[model samples]
Target: MFIRTENFSQYVRAYPIVTFLLALNIGIFILTWIPGIGNQLLLFGIGDNFLIANGEYWRLVTPMFLHGGLTHLLFNMFSLFIFGPELEKIAGKARFITIYMLAGLFGDVATYFLQSGDYRHLGASGAIFGVFGAFGALVYYTKHVFPQLKQVILPIIVISVVMTFVGTNINVTAHIAGLITGFLIGLSYFNPKNIVSWRKKR
Candidate 1:
């Protein structure tokens, strides 16, 4: 019964955070094809986000919704589709959304601090990478318990991080920095003790 509840994925399946984020990213990406509308959209952007232009301080948050191109959106959403359900299950709906948005926000901040002078960047990779790092916590103490998961999940994160760097046409600094921040968040806040829920074995 406990296993059933733990793995049911109810919150993620019906939650607004998941739908809202996906819709926002896809909507913005579609708008990018509209010629002048794309330019105006980004005229208020900040950092490397599309639609971030002209000191739109809000772009710090909005950039998470923008992507560099179709491939970028696909890759980020795929990562979300894969791992986010687990995170939402782990933290519940409210906490899950907080972490997702927070991670993206932190990723944006990292970009701003590291880069300067209107250097632009965009994508959900930073946020998804946060989820990637958060899952690292699951592997830390459960390696023996779930050897299969340990084997699969860690490599995904490592390979993703590596690919962000070793691959061509990527923002290595933002990717790496976002990963580092994400991992730290997972390590610091993820508590294995929380998983041991009990309702009186008797």
Candidate 2:
């Protein structure tokens, strides 16, 4: 249901990394529709215990790129489309990627520990939550820069957290882990020293 407007080009110029990430996710989703390939891709997704314990550690990274269904893919991609450019502009490409991957890895790790062995999870919700955390951290350090961000992001965060517990299939552990991981990473990236230096330059 999401549609790009004229401003989409501006967003692309401002955040090519985010655009590339979106393209990559969409491309993978298209590939997943190819009958047997979908099954192969799902195998790479995060399974709670037995898969990781058996040494398929790569699942930690791969699940972020796989979606459970079309609706899942669209929802996550829409979120990325909405949030990714702004965060990329703030964090820059390298740091943003680091936050995303680390958040996702930590999310998978948490899910591994918290869920029973039989529980399986997939989708980019964990990493998306990390993006939310990064936005919160940035707003925290640069409160004067974007006073309205706190108002906007807080409700989304609360709703997301609440939704996790509302459904049986939702992986609240991964979401929490991703949020905490991103918050910590954001603290490191947007710490007082950096904030002070930025303020001085401004």
Candidate 3:
């Protein structure tokens, strides 16, 4: 179910939400590389608890689109690329974006309240983790009907948790918060019948 066989145009047509997200992320990252304004954008867009506390609340939203470096961007976008389509297809565009934004916002809010005043973060990892969390919720709700699906997501979850700890300079709070938020949102947002209909399409 995760393997993407679609070509460029095909993939875009099939998963417009994921396509738009990918484009927006990559585009923003590119804009961040443009010398002068790049650093300025980073300073302005990064999530700084100090700035946030001072009422620069947009930090919560902008960090979802900012990344520290190429590896950071690639990793988060790769995760989104891999795990996003299924959820987008199942949740539909509106619901999918809602879960993604809420999960990301929740993570950023957690970071603002949990971390130090000086702590700063800029990346889409929280949102990507939310995608994983949504998958978990889907499996949890549909397990009896789709027991075999667990085999697909369980390993990914394990690897993600392990990587979160093993990696350096990670925003542990955001990851955990995003995961919880996504799962909770999924619990309330997903309809079993919708999932069934989505599965039938597959």
Candidate 4:
């Protein structure tokens, strides 16, 4: 079942970090729409190998907050809204922040090394895929407790991989990099043994 927010105030109280992220992305999207601002936003997006090699290292972090278009922004934000809150709650504020950022950075690194040409990249897909990877890891670690999740997780992973190949202009390497980074982080942090104890305490 999907996690649905009842109201704006209640949603903010439940998922402050997710709320802030959503707001920030939306705010940036609005800004980019303003006259003469789209070009400014492009300056912050991830450039090709030469620009990054020239010491524009900040591109790794900034691209995660930029988007190529309204559809790009909407899809990534929707994914974040859906998967972010539960992972944030499970991972806690600091750890969740770490996973989100590291995944995006790793994705950028992958793109920098693997991708060629003068193409620019932007969007939060890398971090969003990180959330998916984290969820997959949790389902894997807790398979005994939640056996049905495997059935759901495998298909999603497969479809994502397939889509990555089929879709034009897709950053398949970034998605894979983020997924692997997130999976390792999740495997290390989310202990299945602690789940029982946490549940009992609750």
Candidate 5:
């Protein structure tokens, strides 16, 4: 892990959105280790759970910080570790973070609206998919912009999407919502005029 960190820092800004996101995720995970903290956090997840019974409407976001188990948490974090830096490089820190959190938020919203009662869900899969979708848009857009990068980047998008879909125990709805959300964000942000506007604002 330390070697990976050293390598990551050598190439990109260590304190970028990726790092912040990872920290937020791991920090929240640690907090969940506290006896009542995890249960309390679980209340806000998308499901027919205690949070739902208690009317904790804010759990949509809160649940995102909690995971069902270690395997679930690790998978999400691994995806973030793998795809995050690349996506951050393309979208930059602020936009990347915005897309990630919004995508997760959107995922939970979709979950809440689509599902029936008595089921709850949580994880950062939504945000991970968002990152993946954004990276896909980068490829789609870059083929026209940089053209040469397609050889490498296009495959990354395909494999990532496939992994998201094929993986077990994934919340497909959240992934789909996140993917669509990310694609839209990428398209809007990369639009010629919007890019100019975005650049100017930044």
Candidate 6:
């Protein structure tokens, strides 16, 4: 299910939400590199608990589109590109974006609540973890129809959780919170109709 064989046009045509998200993320990351305003952009876009406390509530959503560096941008975007399309396909455009935004937002909110006021973070890791969590839900509900999904997606979920702790400066709170939020959302938001519809299309 994870293998991507589509060419650029086909991929874009089939997965508009993923395509738009990839473009939006890459575009914002590029904007943050513009010489004079780069640092300023990072300052404003990053999720700073202190700023959020001061009523800059947008920080929760903004950080999902911001990245600390090229590697950070690439990693998150790559994760989205690989895993996002399938979910978007199954969930449809509206539900897909809702899952992503909710997952990312809950992660940032968790960080705001759990971290020091001075804590700051930028990346889509929380949202990406949410995507994985949704995948876990999908596997659980569809195991009878697609038994191999457990074997495929479960290892990814486990490895991702382990890697979250292994990395430095990682926001463990955001990742965990986003993951739980996503799983719960997935369980309630996605019905058998959506899954069966996706299967029919495939």
Tens digit per residue, CA lDDT, model 5, 141-198: 6567555556765666677678767987667788889888887888766656543443
Mark the regions of model 5 whose C-alpha exceeds 4 Å error after superposition. 1-13, 44-55, 144-168, 191-202
Against the hidden reference, what TM-scores do the models get?
0.80, 0.87, 0.97, 0.91, 0.77, 0.96
Task: Give the C-alpha miss distance for residue 78 in model 6, angstroms.
Answer: 0.9
Global lDDT of each model?
0.68, 0.79, 0.90, 0.80, 0.71, 0.88
RMSD of 1: 4.8
Candidate 2, overall lDDT? 0.79
Estimate, for each residue in 26-89, the C-alpha lDDT of model 4 and write its tens digit.
9888888887876777776655567887888888788888888888899889988877887887
lDDT of 1: 0.68
After the best TM-score superposition of candidate 2, give how far the Cα of residue 76 lies from its true spot, in angstroms. 0.9
Per-residue C-alpha lDDT of model 6 across residues 1-202, encoded as one tens digit per residue: 7789999999999999889989999988898889978888888889999999999999989998888889888888888999999888887888878888899999999999999989999888888888888888988899899788789889988988898899888889888988887788889877898888877877
Clashing residue pairs, backbone N/CA/C < 3 A, model 1: 42-51, 43-53, 44-52, 44-53, 45-52, 45-53, 48-120, 48-121
Clash count (model 3, backbone only): 0
Q: After superposition, how far is residue 76 of candidate 3 from its true place, in Å?
A: 0.6
Give the Cα error of residue 81 in candidate 2, in Å: 0.7
Q: Give the TM-score of candidate 1.
A: 0.80
- Flag the better candidate by TM-score, 4 or 6: 6
Query: Which digits, one per residue and each the tens of the lDDT, describe model 1 over residues 1-202?
Result: 1122333366445445766677788888888779999877755442553334345568677777777778888988867766776666665677667667777778787777676655777677777877777777666756776576678888888788778867886666566666666667667666655544311210
For model 2, residues 115-152, the per-residue Cα lDDT tens digits are 88876888788898898888778777767765666778
Query: 3 or 5, which is superior by lDDT?
Result: 3
CA RMSD of each candidate after superposition? 4.8, 3.5, 0.9, 2.0, 4.7, 1.1
Better of 4 and 6 by lDDT: 6
